[model samples]
Target: MSARLPENPAPLTQALDACRHRDPEGFHRLRQAVAPAMLATALHFVQDVRQSEDVVHDTLLLAWLNAGRFAADDLPPGSWLFTILGSRLHSQLEALAGRPPSAPRAVPTGLQGQALWTLAHGLEPRPPSASLGDRLTESLLARLAAPQLPRTPTGELVHPPLYDARLRRKMLTSRLAYQAKEGFKRRLGRPLEEWAFRRWLAQRSVGQWLEAQGLPRRSVEAALGDRLDLEVNPGRLVRCMSYPDAFPDRTERRKASNLFLWSGDWDLPHHSLADSSRTRFIQDLWTHRLEPSRSETFRRLEQQREQGRPLRSHHKGMLLDSRERILEYLRLYLLYMENMACFGFDKHEGKDRLGVTIDRHGRIIKTNKGLHRLAMAQVLGLSEITVRVRSVHRQWWQRHAGDAKGRDALERVAQALPECVPA
Candidate 1:
C-alpha cells in the first residue's frame, strides 16, 4: 500500500518494469492505480458500466502480456495506456459493426513482391507422400508397367501392378527384419514388428513423425507455412509443392495445383500474394496511378478536370507489365520506378504479406497486410490479386485474458480499484 503510486509515465513505467519481473504485488498495486483511468476512458466510449469494465479488464490483461513490448521510456504512461485502450475499444466497435478487427496495412514495396515470389518459388522441402493405400497403389501401378508383368486383353499390363501378394509379402518381411535389427519398439515397450510399425506409420501424420523424431515442426512449417498464401477463397485447396525448389529440403512429392492466374502481368510493378480491398478514397486519389513519370493520358485527364470538364474513365493509366512508360509532353522521358519490399513471410509470427480484408457488401474494408504492393498493382491497372481475407465471421480480438496463472488475481485487481471519471 506504501508503494509510490505512478502519477505520470516515469513512476508508471517503473511499476510496469517491476511487473515484468513477476512481481505480483507490484503489478496489483499498479493495476489498482491505473484501473480508474482506464475505466473512465472506456466509459467515455461505451457508456455501459459493465461493458466499460470489460474493456478495462481486457486492457489490463494486454498490458500484462505485452508489457515488455511497450516502449515505456519514450512515451508517457498515460499516452501509452490510452493508445492500447483506444485500440482495444476500436476493435470492439468493429466487432459490433459487423466488421473484422483492423489488421496493419502496408504498401507493397518491390522488395515484398520479389521476396515472396523468390522465397515461395525458392528451394524448399517437398511435402510428405500420400497415404499408405494411395502410395502402395501408385507404386504397384508403376511396377506393373514394367516388361515382366502379364498383359491385359488389350495388350496393356494386367491391372498394372496387379496387387501382387508375393511382392507385398516380401516387402513386409524385409521391413520387419529391418525394424527388428534396429531395435525399434512400440509405445507399450514391445519390439516393433513390420505389421505394427506399418499400422502406426499409416495412422500417424507427418507432423506426428517429426515430433517422435525430435525434429522441430518448424522444418516443414517454415517451407510450407504459406500453403494457402496465394489462394483467394479461404476454403481453397492448397498444394504444398509444384514450383521448382518448391519444397527444397525435403524429399516429399506433394505439389501445389490450381494456382489461378489472378493477374496476367507477371512482371508488373507489384504482385500480391494475398487479397486486399480498395476504398473509394484510395481509388479517387488514384494512389495506384502514381508514378515518377506522369503518363500523358492521366495528365490530359487532370487538365480536363481542372477546366471543369468531366474526364473519361477510359484513360490509359500506368503500363501493366512494362517498366518503361512515356511521360506526358516529354516524348522520350521514362518514369522513375520505385521497387521496395514491403512485407516478409515468417513461420512463428504470421508473415507480413500483401492481403486485403473485405466487408459484407464487397467493399475493401482495409488492406490486411501489403499497402505498398496494392498501390503498385493499382498503378499497373491490375484488377484482381490473390490475398488472405479476414472475415467478420472470424473474430481476432483478444477474447480470453489470462495465461498459465488463473484470472483470480486480475479479477481482484479489477474489483478493488476505484472508478475514475472521464476527463
Candidate 2:
C-alpha cells in the first residue's frame, strides 16, 4: 500500500488558504503579521503605551472573532487588522478623561536620545579638502543671524494676569467716555444703560470690520457672537488690548485686543468644565525634565524582572503617563507645523516658533515652511508650482487613482515637498 499522505498542509499555506476561505487562523499568524503597525496606530490614537498595547491585545481578539467576515480581496490581511485596531483605538480615545480629540498637542515617538544623536551625526561628511574652518564660520554666522528671540516681560512670564488691571480700567473708562460723547441714551425700551448699548455698538462695529477684511464670517461670528449675551464675560478682549506691544501692526493689535476682550477666553468654560487642571499639571511636570526622567524610567523598567520585583502598579502607571506625555509632545509638534503652515507663525510663539516672514498674498516668502517646501521640491526635482498645483488638483487624482493609491501618493507628495522647497 502507498504511504498515507500527510493530512495537513504547512501552517502558513494553510493559514493563507484559510484566510482566502474566511476561516479563523487558530495559529495567530494574522496577529503576528499585523501587530507592529497595529501597536503603532494604537499608540498614536491612545497616546499611552500600556493602553495602546492593551488596545492591540483587544484588537487581536476582535480580529480573531471577526476573521470569518474579513474578505481577502477587500482589505488584505494587514489593512483588515489595522481597521479593527483603529476602531478600538478611536473608541478608547473618545473615553479618555480630561482630553479632547481637538487638543492642540501631540505625542513624541519616544526615540532614544543616544539613537537620535547617532543617527543625526552619521550623515556623510564633507571632503577632507573642504575648508572646515569656513564651514564652521558659516554655520556660526547663520546661527547668529537667526531672528531675535521673543522676550516675555517680567510680569508676563509666570502666572500672568488674564488682563492687566490698569488696562481693564482704561478700557472701561474709555467706553464710558465714548458712550457719553455719542449721546446714546438708553434707546432700548429695556432698562439697559447707555454704556451697555455703546459696548454692543463697539462689538458690532468690530464684527463688521472683520467681515470686510475677508476673515471667515463664521469664524468672526463664532469668536464674537455672544458679545451681546449678558451672561458671557469678555475678559479676553482686555488681555489682548493689554498686549499691544506683542502685535506687529497697530490696527491688527487694536482689532485683536477688541476681539479678545469681547471673546473673554472662549476656551475657558470648556476647559473648566472638563477639569483639565490635572492634565495641565501633568503636562508641565513632563515638560520640565522629559529626557532624563524618561531615560531613568525606561532603565528602571527594563531591569524590573532581574530586580526580583514584578511590575508594580505605580511603575506601570508611570510608564503609561510618560508614554502619554511623549505622544502629546509629538501631536503638539505636528499641530505647530500645521499652524505655521496656515498662519505664518506658531500660535503660541514658543521656543519652537519659526519666525519666517510672509507676504501679503498669503505666500510664504521667507518662512521655514516656504524654504522647506522649496528644498524638498528641488531634491525631488519637482517644480514648486507643480507641487502647489498638485495639491490643488488632489481631488482629480483621488477620483482616478481610487482611495488607497491616492492617499499613498498624497502622503508621498507631502514627504517629498520639503526636499524640493528651499530651507
Local accuracy of candidate 1 as per-residue lDDT tens digits, 1-423: 222224455667776776566455545655656665555555555666655564555555556545665575666655555555554565344434544222332322321322322232322322212342243233333433544543322223322222233333444454456556445433332322233333333444442342233222222223234442332322221111112232233332121111111111111122222332232222322332224234444455456545665332111112121122122212111111111111112112223455433222222222325443444344333323455432210111011112311223223322322221101
Best candidate according to TM-score: 1
lDDT of each: 0.35, 0.33
RMSD of each: 29.3, 23.6
Quote the lDDT for 226 in model 1. Answer: 46
Clashes of each: 31, 39
Which lDDT tens digits does candidate 2 get at residues 275-343?
233223323322322232344333453365346552422211212124333333333332222222222
Which parts of model 2 are misplaced by more than 4 Å?
A: 1-27, 97-423
Report the error of model 1 at residue 203, Å: 41
For this target, which candidate reaches the highest lDDT against the unseen true structure?
Answer: 1
Instruction: In model 2, state the lDDT of residue 354.
Output: 19
